[model samples]
Target: MVVSNIISGYQKTQKLSVAPFRQMQSAFDRDCLFTEKIYIIGYSFGDKHINEMIRVAITHNPNVKIIIIDPSYKDEKAKKAILEIWSDEIITPQVENMKFGEFLKQQIK
Candidate 1:
């Protein structure tokens, strides 16, 4: 999927004019994909990035869902708090730190 960052109210393309926001929207529209069925996975340095991704995904597809696996950062409590907030979306079916194989299996089911 395409990825981009929102900066100062404007979308800054890290690459070419092939901006991430446009690309992501195109992918979804072309495929006639459903936002609720889509998943965004991230970890570590990706913690904030993943949030940004979800923000963008939701802006484009309001019904989109997200799943994040952020191991305790700053503190365990903070991580737990973030996970709780992440649970608000109805489309989010699961959120955990399972192995890649296990995550894949669960997603497929």
Candidate 2:
């Protein structure tokens, strides 16, 4: 059985009504608020809900650290674009310009 609450495509009117989605969102918010470090991987910052949660978390916890890992961020333009998404907040997230596999290998070493 596959249980997913993913909003596919550009359906802007779709709302997350499933219990699992709610639970997951709640957990994500809790983790964002309490966790000292957040490592983001391959997220495009397209989801408004997720972005808003992250913004709120940053605002609530100014000392929390953010680490973003994405190969595209190797380019200065791409890194700037990602940073611009959160321009409203005063943050300088540590960026890892590498693929997930490479990051995992480094972590295992």
Candidate 3:
């Protein structure tokens, strides 16, 4: 299941453009608004900006559920950042350090 999309992003010139980033932000924002649950898997995303967008999405959808699956739990920082944003508020987000296959079998069921 290798899905892909052609969206505006960084170019080869090593220059940062505002339009593409904003486009992504707008798209993710809309996605967050409509989705009832978000399953974010893996640390391969490796982008702080993208992680921030996820956090903001969680904020936009207060009652939404978030399931984070990252082995080694190295991406705990991203989760911590989200907690800080909504201090004293419990979002009931679940974090798991499990292999993708295990998650599919045990969690998806």
Candidate 4:
């Protein structure tokens, strides 16, 4: 929530600080670790800390599903890092370079 809300807060203040970054980052890490699977909607996964959490899930929880729906996740480096951390054993979950609505429509069809 902090990550998402930060955008709006920045719009008002036009500035941001690192004071709350650690707390929210820790929360995201905890959620990623505790949850069985993670569904990343619009997140770019550019944050190093969140990326580490994803890697942790991939390495430690093969059963955990990772469903990512983001059109902007086209960076080859990011994709490679994800696949490398995930390895080849676990079946990759749903991922698509499209809007959630469009993706869901296709899924329904």
Candidate 5:
């Protein structure tokens, strides 16, 4: 039920100082390890820790599928960055040039 895991930009330092924040990050890492598919929506891929977690998950489970839904992914630079992170030949993520709402509508249909 608690969706907001990381602290806001103003509280960035608190992320490292707070125990609960560390636990939340650990939980995210654990989930990545077990999840077969990951749907990343509108994430800037700015968090090195989260990016590393996903990389580790893919390394541990090569069969894991990644779906990235963000309009900016249509840009070559943005798309290239994401591909570079999950850069295994077998771990090709399904990149979509659409927003989350649009993706959901298509899925519903």
Candidate 6:
């Protein structure tokens, strides 16, 4: 798995004096090249970055299915506009406001 490789790579190179963030980004880029799909899960501040990444990824991989697990979709118009544009491309454009337990249950099923 890409995630496993990421963690293992991090562990192996923790003391290698390289910028871990850059290395991880490179790893993700390489893995994504041949990846059929990607499931990005994030919460809180990470939620912001993940949302941004989703936009960027979707721009590149227009058909890549995305799941925005718990984004703050408080802006109704913005949410609707985004869904209109990206619904077909994403697995679920808005799972943001759902309770974590319910979201997990739905995802598993």
Alpha-carbon error at 41 in model 5, in Å? Answer: 0.7
Tell me each candidate's RMSD, in Å, in order: 7.2, 2.7, 5.3, 5.8, 3.2, 7.9
List, residue by residue over 1-109, the lDDT tens digit for candidate 2.
5676565676433445456667777788899999899888987776777777777888899988888898887566446535644677778778898999999999999
User: In model 1, which residue pairs have backbone atoms overlapping below 3 Å?
Assistant: none
* TM-score of every model versus the real structure: 0.40, 0.79, 0.58, 0.58, 0.79, 0.45
Worst 10 residues of 4 by lDDT: 7-16
User: What tens-digit string does per-residue lDDT give for candidate 1 at 40-78?
Assistant: 344442344335455455555666555544333245543
Q: Which of the predicted structures, 1 or 6, would earn the higher TM-score when compared with the native?
A: 6
* Runs in model 4 lying further than 4 Å from the true structure: 1-18, 72-78, 81-84, 88-91, 103-109
Q: Model 5: how far is 28 from its true place, Å?
A: 0.5
Tell me the tens digit of each residue's lDDT in model 5 across 7-96: 667656456556777778778888899998988888877766667888898899788899989887756745655575766645777889
The C-alpha stretches of model 3 lying farther than 4 A from their native spots are 1-25, 44-46, 74-80, 83-89
Which window of 10 residues has the lowest lDDT sum in candidate 6?
1-10
**For candidate 6, lDDT tens digit of each residue in 3-103?**
32233323433432356655665666555544656644443322333344555566676666645554454556445536644455554444456656767
Candidate 4, residues 1-109, lDDT tens digits: the string is 3355343422332222344655665676677777886887887554544566788867676678888788876677457645655555465656777988998898799
Cα lDDT listed for each candidate: 0.47, 0.76, 0.63, 0.65, 0.77, 0.50
Give the Å shift of residue 19 in candidate 6. 2.3
TM-score of 6: 0.45
Candidate 2 Cα lDDT to native: 0.76
- Clashes counted in candidate 6 amount to 0
Compared with the true structure, model 2 gives a TM-score of: 0.79
- Residue 65 of model 6 has an lDDT of 61
Best by lDDT: 5
